[model samples]
Target chain A: MSERPAHGWQTVREEVLRRIAEKIWRPGDPIPNEADLAAELGCARATVNRALRSLSDDGLLDRRRKGGTRIARQPVGRATIEIPLIRTAIAERGARYGYRLIERQEAVAPGAVSAALGTAADAAFLHVVSLHLADEAPYALEDRWIVLGTVPEARDEGFEAISANEWLVRHLPFTRAESEFSAVPAAAARSGALDTAPGDALIVHRRRTWLGDKPITQVDMTFAPGHRIRTQQ
Target chain B: MSERPAHGWQTVREEVLRRIAEKIWRPGDPIPNEADLAAELGCARATVNRALRSLSDDGLLDRRRKGGTRIARQPVGRATIEIPLIRTAIAERGARYGYRLIERQEAVAPGAVSAALGTAADAAFLHVVSLHLADEAPYALEDRWIVLGTVPEARDEGFEAISANEWLVRHLPFTRAESEFSAVPAAAARSGALDTAPGDALIVHRRRTWLGDKPITQVDMTFAPGHRIRTQQ
Candidate 1:
């Protein structure tokens, strides 16, 4: 069995992960060197090295040039935040997704919005507000500002038929983005749109995206009370 | 310079990152193959391979057996969620951190909490409530349940001087954890402890951790209105 068939790097990665998960190798305990592990597992040394490097990237193991590799003593749960399309999110849950365009107009960028996008204070932008629903109930209220200077094509695509949220995600692929998660009391407008009483607590997701140095858009999504987001590695 | 001195893989990774950040290779554009990049950068092929593999894990590059490697068009910001100690978080922001124990008691685990921990309902747990303060202002309220079966040592840690939140982080090195983010209205008890009006919106972070198959602890942290969490890659 030592000279068994060749395997992919992913197979070696999963085996290493299983060993760590099973406590066969406890936290802070150094595992065998790459050459030794490769010999024992009947895999190439290069494959074993790749697997260990990947595990280290996930905060599962600590690797050093001279000290070798060991499991992390205190592993920070390294989760990937995949910003999904709103429609796709609802669809994955087997819920019927609904979208309605509330308002759209060309307006001067607000001070906060301008600061978020790193644009001039009073720069003109296309302001759009839309509501997303799951099963005909309010799920989230999106308020967005798209910089016309950065995305000129947005001017031609009037947002009356399609949401600026979906449109931007499809048309503009950003290189850099910043996002914040917070809670806020539902204001008058938010309450009306979300069908909730004013002053009710709501979770808010705010994001700003840029393509290289050009700021594309900034958006704030306010979810109805009891809305939750689960993330996993 | 074709035979440049040996360097660590991290050095090559950063150099590749700088080139991408500078837009020398635009998104959707393929850079040279591994052999070519190694030769041009005067590094070992294995070193270059490690750097490319790391970048691919980060969602910055797409690599395939036949496709070589190319910049990502729509990069999903891969962020590592480093669950920080609240005290450290407040101190990092240049604010004074304070902890107050609200209540402690032995009680049956709630149905939801029990299910989250994969334990049977009615299992006795050490329920602890506490408040975290930043510069004398209410910051977050924590509600936690420690599995007595898995963590009997917690019974001795009365949690008067040190918070259970901090204590668990120090004592427990969990191998598995799940977290959820949501918004909920501040109920009467939560409002009183958090110094917010009833029905006000609050951000809630819920987490359950396990050591191998044994459940360790589950915690819910509710932040005051306007509290924000920013995560980035």
Candidate 2:
């Protein structure tokens, strides 16, 4: 089925893949052309194209420029990345989830923080230091700064009762954000955050969220060594 | 607009973010709820939800329970993991893309490969080791094993001209896939895959793609110490 249709790419791909997998089109065997499949399925050629395109991307078929499509000789690995909530991810894995407000204070925005918050450098900002836990073990250290100019109500919204994630979900109203994932060798402070050895490689997720036409928050989320975020495509 | 809409989430998000950048909703300003947004945009609520949910996730709005949503005090960093061709990623970064044909043997699958390929444990399999280069720099060392029993035709397919990634995309007919992302300290032989310093964090992508119920490929893609993949939500 098309994304526009009830049966999306997953459904059609399943049907086609089952045929090939069952040796309906054994390796080296040519599969039906897109036109034929489109007509057979009462769908457009584009729908078939999407299915084939994804299958090819996943390394299941042999599609060449004008050579047509065939079953792959050997399937290649297909991997997907999943984004997860930090707290649940830790807890589900049988780890304790804890948060510590290391630094929470009212301050003036620095140039960089101001730029990130889309506020003037002199704007009031809330700087909060937080440590995250997994199974009572130190997992991540977060150095988060909130724009007090933008969140006056946040001045007294103690983070002790709930987690920043849950609080943000409830009070923060930005409709857009960006997440950057990277790996870096650990520095001392970072090592302290994760209870890691010196020079440990850390998986870093730096996230920024924005209100409509306004800058709001910047969070630096650094994970302990061996931490992973799973995702699918 | 929807997935079928001219602008996908990416395009819409950028536009909306720009509006917010322009201060349509300044920091701490309350924005309309999603329902009102859907109405104003004349699009599906789901689309609005996707956009809004992403925004909330990014920490732009201070979302509350019936208290309404507002801009964050400080904007979060935009964390984007760029999903590019592995080859392109290395090449663009001025490293040589390298490959090595580890073992070109046709044999029955091993335990895990068998289960993944949906074939007998002894299903014909092709094992190869290839290294990815970035401008003559070692970026990734791949230990790839393919099960030919499920897709036997790859037995004679020459993998010389193209990278496994490119070759696989051109060939294969898979329907569903699952992948896992992890960060692990380098294993023994792996330490030499990309000439990494021992104990550096290596980002590992473990994946298994399926054709219908038939397992097709199981692969482990290990990045060098500094490789990063970015995705925006």
Candidate 3:
């Protein structure tokens, strides 16, 4: 292989990753300091630093403030969990996507919902129930509560043409989000909606999003049995 | 609030992120180049670069080689998923953990396994079946295949004392890993092992690890109903 001095930071990053993959820099071994790496690679020290920092973010390197950087002895591979818009998720699976709005109304927030939203227990919010179908089969049932104070426009949009999921993504892009995945037994009402047997184990993907300090929305989505979510770098 | 020149890259990062969050630099707006930001902040361009790079990594900013940097119009919040060790995962949940080695044998690779491993269909591998218990209740069942050429020492370890999962983590320390999560119906064999009804939905966490180009191991772990995994950022 013809070799030339690597130029850009990304090129340096690839070189470093390849070295690590080849075991040239074994785990737990201290790599050269920034200055030395810069000298050897004939690049600016900042470029080398950027490459190292990116690798550290990927959990490939362990960098300390003073102790320098080292190959992580117990490197944990991080998988990025991208919160997918349900429509895109379904379409990616090569299935015809369908949506039906079951119910939409303004209701007093329950204790749990209010607590999760960090709002008054008696606060009223727009609550909506919708079903997502893949190939005309029930794929997921979504129960969502929208804080009107954070998303007042949601009250006017009748979710008949566009799903609240898509609406929020377009209007309010969240700065922070949390997701919880679990297997739960389907209750009677949910079973009838999802067309699954009562007590059948269903996958729940619960998510809450925030726009700065304001809670945007919280949704509990229960998927039909045999649903899958894949995460990768 | 007193204003002072930021001293370090991390402070610069915080300031930049706060700006983006507060809409001082609104989404889809082009940010100043690194040199100008460094001049404005009275720091080196490298420091500004570091801050901008970090924000980009967090999905707060979008950077293109030629297009420069801009606030992402539709920013997607990324959740870092740390691959968990089952023992540590259970212990973190405040549950007593137990393990049992159900079966271990050398078997010819099946079609799917061979395809995944990229090996001959008739190649023999060490297959293991084990069960994890939480508070004396069935928790998960693990079915694993270890490549003999990559991990020959696994043949000597009886797995009665230490699990293959922990053993591989300690010995192999794979450089790469892939994980997939899905809800699956428990088959007759898996149901008997997990003490669950056949056709009950189980959460499956399938993972494969590699050391460079060599396949190290592949495991399919099925969790009991009600199991949960949470990720936040």
Candidate 4:
């Protein structure tokens, strides 16, 4: 029987990575055109194009419309931060996950929250405050606003048993999102919820999700002191 | 006269994104197989495959080897953080960029630094501390260690005019890197350099880069208070 052909784009991508890692194609070196590379590797030109595009997205290669492809001279390291479900993140650490809803009510969104969601300052939203715990210790304090105009169901459903974070993931469809990462001193009110002292350094993660052009939710999560987001590329 | 063919992978990708955005392919819905999609779109099977794979990488689709592809029910929002050269970042902000070498000396690497670099505990490294300024205001304080065994040229040069951050990027070839983002209280020593009060919240970014298995350098950058990293997807 003939062996299965190993000409997939993934195999091509691996070969390209190997060449760069081994310095076979040194930095700033211009790689062969896709057509030439496909001919040499005995694969379709489309396969080579796909592999090169993937590598370029990863910041390993530079491809210009008319400049062909070259190994990146000063490769900007790209670290992909995948914001996981808070409960899943806790469970992944071999810790028991706990969540408690502190407050849920229809309230007018703050000016910043309104601006982030592209809603009016007087827009009423389903406001939710909750705490996520890992091993019964404070993990993250979540403050969320759901645009009632886009998600009318949120106003009726009480988020007492389930967090809006998890509920929205199951109920809504997100097509786009924006996130901001910063450091902030914990306010007195939030510090009590997170079980940290006031003025303690905290990692603040603010995120907004959209379904098409309609805003779904805007959330700010303040992690307990010493929380870190780590990634490798 | 025939018009140019519009059957590329990019066209397929755009169509897929549109369907998802329009809720035509709702979350958790299984998408058509590659062969069927290719026939329907009048494109090659490889083009459909490439488009689907790209979407899967972006966390929009979940493709199982035996189960086929489906729209992700709980799509993980991926934020790509590109760590740019400090000078370039400042210039992009429309600020005058400035750099100052606080200290540069050959010293024994600290235990934590050596461990991070995968070097000996007693390894001697080029220790460099520098301050990056935007519009004459301190932006970030950088503490870096260069592995002498892998980058011996760093030991001969004094980083007085150009920062080690810029020098390494121009001289080295990076195959892989790891980054960590955390919140920390500014220490007294660093607080002075950043012109911030002690115990202020700061965004601490730690990065280690490698050429294959060999470590090139490890650096810790502590940004001034209120600095935020933002990204959209």
Q: List the residue pairs that clash in candidate 3.
A: none
Q: Could you tell me the C-alpha RMSD of candidate 2 in Å? A: 8.2
Q: Is candidate 1 or candidate 3 better by DockQ?
A: 3
RMSD each, Å = 6.8, 8.2, 6.6, 6.6
Highest lDDT: give the candidate number.
Answer: 4
In model 1, what are the clashing residue pairs, if there are any? A201-B201
DockQ of each: 0.31, 0.29, 0.32, 0.41
Interface RMSD for candidates 1 onward, in order:
4.6, 6.5, 4.2, 3.5
Model 3 regions more than 4 Å off: A1-71, A186-188, A197-200, B1-71, B75-77, B186-188, B192-200
Best by TM-score: 4
In model 1, how large is the Cα lDDT of residue B97?
Answer: 94
Query: Between which residue pairs do clashes occur in model 4?
Result: none
Model 2: per-residue lDDT, tens digit, B1-233?
A: 22665545554566567656555666677777778877777766777768766777766656888778776665223333444457766667676666665445665556876665567766666766677776666777666667675667677776766666555544555566566566666544555767777656777776666656656677777887776665454
Model 2 lDDT on a 0 to 1 scale: 0.67
TM-score of chain B of 4: 0.77
Of the pair 1 and 4, which is ahead by lDDT? 4
User: By TM-score, how accurate is candidate 1?
Assistant: 0.77
lDDT of 3 by residue, A54-112 (tens): 77876667898888898876624566777678888889889999999999999887788
Using DockQ, rank the candidates from best to worst.
Answer: 4, 3, 1, 2
Candidate 3 is graded, for docking, as acceptable
Ranking by TM-score: 4, 1, 3, 2
